[model samples]
Target chain A: MSNFINQILQSEKTLAFPIMTHPGIEALGKTVREAVSDGEIHYQAIKYISEHFDTIACTSIMDLTVEAEAFGAIINLPEHEVPSVTGRLVNDLKSVGSLEVPTLDKGRIPQYLLANKLAAENIRSKPVFSGCIGPFSLAGRLYDMSEILMDIYIEPDVVNQLLEKCTEFLVNYCRALKATGTTGVIIAEPAAGLLSDDDCMMYSTVFVKQIVDAVQDDNFTVILHNCGNTGHCTNAMIASGARALHFGNAINMEDVLKQCPENVVVIGNLNPVGVFKQGTESSVRKATQKLMTETAGYKNFVISSGCDLPPFVPEENIRVFLETVKSNNV
Target chain B: MSSELLTKLSECVEFGKINLASPYPPQMKGLPGADEITKEALESGVTPGEILNDALISAMNKVGQKFSENKIFVPQMLLSAKAMGASMIHLKPFFANGSVQRKGVFILGTVFGDLHDIGKNLFGMMVEGAGWEVIDLGIDVKIEKFVEAVKQNPTAVVGISALLTTTMVNMKPVIEAIKAISPDTKVIVGGAPLSSDFAAQIGADGYGKNPQEGIVWLDKLTA
Candidate 1:
């Protein structure tokens, strides 16, 4: 086990590791566009959120579009909303064969790496886990999600070839992130959750396992995150060999914990959008307390937002969530 | 022989076998897929309506049920949709003329500010397979677009989708705008972050947890 996971296991208090960075934009009075495009701004957002909130780790923004943008996919960066891939870069086997694996200097890769470096150097109180899109998710972005799903059956070889390229790029990217003095990365593979368990193992986890083997170590951990999963692909997620598995609120947290081993740390799954962004402060407290009470028996369970807390989530709701979890002793 | 061929066509769609050349389900490889069997069934004196009701809709019903039960996922669903699509190509002319009629019109779109459309597309496809005429407004659909669609097809049912918590809030005003224009239009809301309570709070007539659930509600309306 990595030192990060060991520390988490040794800690008596159930920790909070919400995938958040948008709240800091409010603190810095910066637009979402500026924070996502500039490394210094992104690092400042992480730092501000870390200093203000009592979380187990300082996690970078979970931007799924950065890697796709690096691969030349068009992106739409809304002023207050998270960026998204607007157009696909690869459409056919010919395009897939000619697609280039972008260098570390491409697109927003440098900005994210700098943010992790700064956060690792400055945030001594907690580990800094950088975020990146998983291989299948990246390939889906480049090839188009619906197209890839159909191609996975109709053109299996083409999909596998594209996945191989995606995995190659991710391994290199993970290595670069590790060199930034960060503890590990949360590879967001929500796209994999859309597949059946067997297909997920064949198309997503096999490649993700390659990345885990390449970069994961005692000093570096990998937390596999899949917000789109609805309890169908939990075993496939476990097969990725990530030290920790983070799930979205689409499934019951207790059901997932039952399927997981006690040694591998399991974190998740308060609804970030429903409870944190839209629900009342009172609702947030109830939801958090409910989750904590349900998972109290599992030593490896850690409380967290199911996915990233989107922009403009109420501060009072986040406060209520953290306060409830802190007050509830396992 | 005709019934057996229809059974083959239905199996092709249920298993996502697109055509003979498609290599999807390993067991079904080298056999006739939805395309070949659908065409063959037509030439063998199978009426387009019989093919429509007995094969395509029947297969999609099972697909939707499996999806709701979590027995299948998106890839399988997409394959089944593609197979159904392949069969639909042969039946379009019959519907274009006076030989057959669709159930009703379903206007669909992802709410504005939310570009995610996978869920919307799946719902649209399932509704289409279930014999409804779907007018897709695509992603990032504006309020006016939906209101205008409702105005044009006043008697049509409307389905709005959103994948983000931020965008799900937008469903309320869109629903309100549609209701104001066409007070009798049955509006349905769906997506990942939605709940039955949220749907009711937002004044949506119904909420579909999955595409299958939405199809069930739509079928009930026509029934």
Candidate 2:
């Protein structure tokens, strides 16, 4: 296990590791587009958030589009919103064979790498984790999410071919992120959560495990983040051998904790939208305390937003969330 | 023979056997799939309504129930939908000639600023399979477009979807606009970020946690 995981496991206090960074654009006076596209702005946003919040680690923007964009997928960059892949790039087996594995220099990757490098250098107090879209999620973006889901059954070999290329690219990408002095990379595989447990094991877990094995060591870690899982594929996720598991708010954290091994750090599952972006300060406090109390018996539980905090999540709500977690320290 | 064909067709739809050539489900290999079975049922003098009600609708309901119970996930549900679509091709002519009647019209869309449509499309397919005429407006649907769709199909139930927390807030105005144009029109809202409380807060007539729940609400409306 990495020292990062060891520290989290040994800590008595419930740690806060919300997948946050976008809201720091509020202080930077920058739009979402500017922050995502520019390295300095992205670094500054992470810096600002880490300085303000007492988090165990600082995470980069959980933008799922950056790696897809690097793979030559057309991205829709909204000025104030997280970007999305507008359409698919590959549709057939021939195209999958022809798809190129991009280098770190491709499409805003350098910018993201620079952001993480800067965060690693500057944020000395806490571990800095860079974020990337997981292999299956990136492949889904390249082949279209709906189309790929059906393709998994219709053309298993073709989907496997595409997944091989995706896994290859991600292994290299995570290696590059590791070279940037960051502590680890959080592979966001929300797309795989749409699969049944067996299918998830076949198409997602196998590839994620490959990446986990390729880049993870004592000095670095792999944290698997799946916001789309509804409790069906927790075993598949655990089998990936990631050092930590991060969940979204779609399932009950207590149930997931029961399925998880006590030594592996299990982080997550406060509703980022319902309780943070849309709820009142009192609601944030109540939700945080409720989650903490529900999983209070588990030593490995970490209190966090179920997913990345959206751009306009109220600052007061975030403040209340942190304060509540701190005040109710186990 | 006709009843056997209908049973076979329903099994094809439930198991996602698209056609004879499809290699899925491993055990069902070399047998006819939904496409061929549906055609054989029609040629053997099975009524179109029987094929639809007994095969397509019955199979899709099982798919929905399995989905709601987590016995299956999206990939399996979508394959079942594809199989149903194959059978529906044989039944479309009957609907056009008024030999068969649909339950009602359901107008669906993902609200503006949200491009996610996996949920919307799945629900649309399920509704279509359940004998409802579905007018899917696609993603990033503006409020005016929804109001216009409601204006055309005034009695139709409106189902709006938004997958993002940031975009789900957009559901409020779209629901309000549809209600303004047709107050009696029932509007249902769904998405990852939505809740029953959020649906009521936004004046939605109902909230569907999944496509099956949405179908249940739609069935209750006409029942």
Candidate 3:
């Protein structure tokens, strides 16, 4: 039986699995023996995930700074690391007035589109997720964080104005990526958790609702991902119109499961460093077993890390997670 | 602002009022937010040290407690921080003159291979709000930078954050490096990939489940 199917059978004692790795794809080099090096790192991520596990996707590191870069912010692309913006786009609130929704073809948008297209072809029959930076996170990237927060108070109108444009860009980008044949899109909104419940409803949820509403369809699903403590914003995320939610390690998986609507799927609560990066395979397997048992019998759950996998995590541990799950099949 | 006004300003901060002109919770809109009250206290002859200690520090302590309990979200805490920041602007001269005392120093950064920092930044701000002087190293930080920071600060607490699973592993050696240099320096670890067990394994002195928890741990260490 497939390891993934065995996991579904609920007989596995362990269920640790590796999260996607973006840079590892680049390490494959240009050798023909490494057939995985067919396209960008994101596509290679899809191929790698599909070959090893039940699900397939990239965490979208084509450059975390892509949108910010396109927004005319100065970006620092270190040779060995993912790109980041050095400063904010709206250094002054006056700059926000000039900003507009960028074309999807601009910046690294083409890279995502192409990656999604390739993932669609390589990850046949498996769920392929294309991720986009949610409006608020992108806004922080475009504008320096300090300035953004200051603007939130001194010029909320400008913040709102920028949010609308950012939302438009993200929605269009999500739709375009979805059209590339992805099963879903993961909206990475690490910044939304920073808002109060009302602000979440007003700024975060309001914009996200518009995006989800604009992208509604059976062909694609929206998975909300916030890599911050999101317990306060979980309901707001649900209200924002996502079908699933992915959270950081700080969140209580049990609490999230209990609080979220029954139909809302929950993926992950693994200690990425504790188990996947540092612990032994046995430890990882045990943790997965514990997690599965903790939230047992709920179809709304998927075994995943609390967040993205660390690059140096041993692949053997991942193999062990799959093996343990497969071995447990009833 | 008189000492009495400073005391009142602190109350405004403790409850989270951005400025005297703002009305968030609606009860204190026109009465005076942290901004106006703090300024008023300063003008009314309140010493900067009194404002920093009695008003700003005390208010942030309440904000931190509320945050740890989940009674507040990022926006509320941020508002409190903003209020604190606005008030701190007036106290900068006092710090320069040695009239106000900062608790200690903290050097914070996201671990290598991790690109996310919203959590890391929030923790830095919160720690700063708690009266510690913070030197933010920003995201995708390397181990050497931390070593250098520890070398400079000597007694400064080192904090490492990583929001990505892929990047969290890099923290292990970073933590080890700090201990190698200054074993006495407290090492606090947080982020999405870490937990208490992981923190223990990494030999970190403490692990915060959230930014507020980090501040609490730091305060306890200094206390």
Candidate 4:
């Protein structure tokens, strides 16, 4: 692993979702979704965020949609809120085959790539892990989610073809990301969590392994995130060869962490919504401390939000979370 | 023969056999499905109430319980829901003719600023299968819209869902506004972001971890 990966391995820290958007919505007086589309604002937000928490990530705002939008999926962008994929672009084998993988400049991808490069060049102390969606998740966005699940059973060849194309684009995207002097990439495949372990292995894990092999090494690590799996497919997720694993609030973090290889890093899974954005300061601190106590035995464990913390999460709550982690070092 | 029809209809729903034309489940391929059996029941002089309470609701309850217990999943529950919907098509006319009754109405939606609806749709379908008239407001519904829906539906139990942490906080206000206008309207809350503790904290009447649990709550509420 790279020195950055090696460093994170040495120390326990609180790493989480978009800090720029959290402050952008609360302090900067701009909509985070809109701000993230602009690389300069995204960099500034990360810079502003770095002062608060070390080992912060580049703006992971809507990492789920960039690939789908690039593949010509219609996106519904609301000014002050998260963007969503509106219509499915792939319906059948012909449609999946007709999909043309767009260049790096397609949609708002370059902005994210730019933000990663800028953050890496500026922030010299800690790691700047960039975020991207995984192949199964990107494919799920391009087609109907439920249909894709059923299709995996009935139309395996078509789904595999779509996954191949998705993985091809992701491999290219990760290569471009690695060239940007970033520390690592977190490939989020939350949609694959909805599948059975066998299906997840066949469809999600194998495809993610291809990307991991292509992009990851001792110099650059791959962190696999599956908020959807809820520990049901934890074994399949670990087998993807991602150096780090991040889970969601659907399953207990302590239990999930136990399933990880002893050497691998485990990050998770405070309730980003119920406990972070919506919780009071005392409650946030209590939840974080409780989680720390629960997972205290796992030295490989790193405390993090179960998923991305939403915008306008009270600055106080954020402070308590960071402080709770810092004060209670294992 | 009549009891046999009811058992067959229930079996069709329980097994998620949509129709004779549906080729799913492999072994049940060529057999008549929920739609075919429900129609046969009606023609053979089975009452709509018996068909609903005995076969349809029973089948859905088993599905719901299985879902809660992790015996089946979303895809399977959805298949069962599609089968139930197919049967409901033939039975809907009986309600208009005053031969059948509904349990009560259920008003549900994903709260404002949240666009996710797959969970809401499933819950609505399950509640509908349980013999309640479900008024789904769809996603990104404002609190005023919820209040207005409560005003219109009056006695209907309200359910609110939010998939995001930001939008889940909005569930509190929707619950507040609906209760502010109609205190008797029991408001239920659920989502990936919400917990029973949060639901109780927000003054909601109950919380459903899954759609089946929501139906169980609604059944107890109207019971």
Best by TM-score: 2
Return whichever of 1 and 4 wins on TM-score.
1
Query: Recovered native contacts in candidate 2, as a fraction?
Result: 0.72
**B37 Cα displacement, candidate 2 (Å):** 1.2
Q: Point out the worst 10-residue segment of candidate 4 chain A by lDDT.
A: A12-21
Task: Mark the regions of model 2 whose C-alpha exceeds 4 Å error after superposition.
Answer: none
Per-residue lDDT of candidate 1, residues B1-223 (tens digit): 8899989989999999999999889999899899999999999999999888999999999999998888888889999998999999999999889697889999999999999988899989999999988999999999999999988998899999998777899999999999888888999999987889889999999899989989999999999
Judged by whole-model lDDT over C-alpha atoms, candidate 2 comes out at: 0.91
The residue-by-residue lDDT of candidate 3 on B1-223, one tens digit each, is 2767866777676655777677654677677777777667777777777777777777788888887777876666776777777787777787778877899999999898666676777788788778888899988789999999999999899999986555666888999898888889889899765678878877889999877778778889878
Each prediction's whole-model lDDT (CA): 0.91, 0.91, 0.71, 0.81
**Candidate 2 DockQ score?**
0.76
In model 1, which residue pairs have backbone atoms overlapping below 3 Å?
Answer: none
Identify the superior model by DockQ, candidate 2 or candidate 3. 2
Instruction: Report the Cα interface RMSD of each model, rounded to 1 decimal.
Output: 1.3, 1.1, 3.8, 2.3
Tens digit of lDDT per residue, candidate 4, span A1-330? Answer: 656456656665543433234564446566666665777677666666765664345444545787888888888776766677876799898998888888888998899888888878997755677778999999888987767866675467889999999999999999988888887888989888877777789999999999999989887888888988766789999999998888888888877876887778888888777787789999998998998889876767777877777767787787888877778863
Estimate, for each residue in B1-223, the C-alpha lDDT of model 2 and write its tens digit.
Answer: 9889988999999999999998876789888999998888889899999998888999999999999999999998998999899989988899999998889889999999999988999999999989898999999999999999999998899999998877888999998888777889999999988999999999999999999999999999999
Quantify how close model 3 is to the true structure by its C-alpha RMSD in Å.
Answer: 4.9
* Greater-lDDT candidate between 2 and 3: 2
For model 3 chain A, the run of ten residues with the poorest summed lDDT? A30-39
Quote model 2's TM-score.
0.98
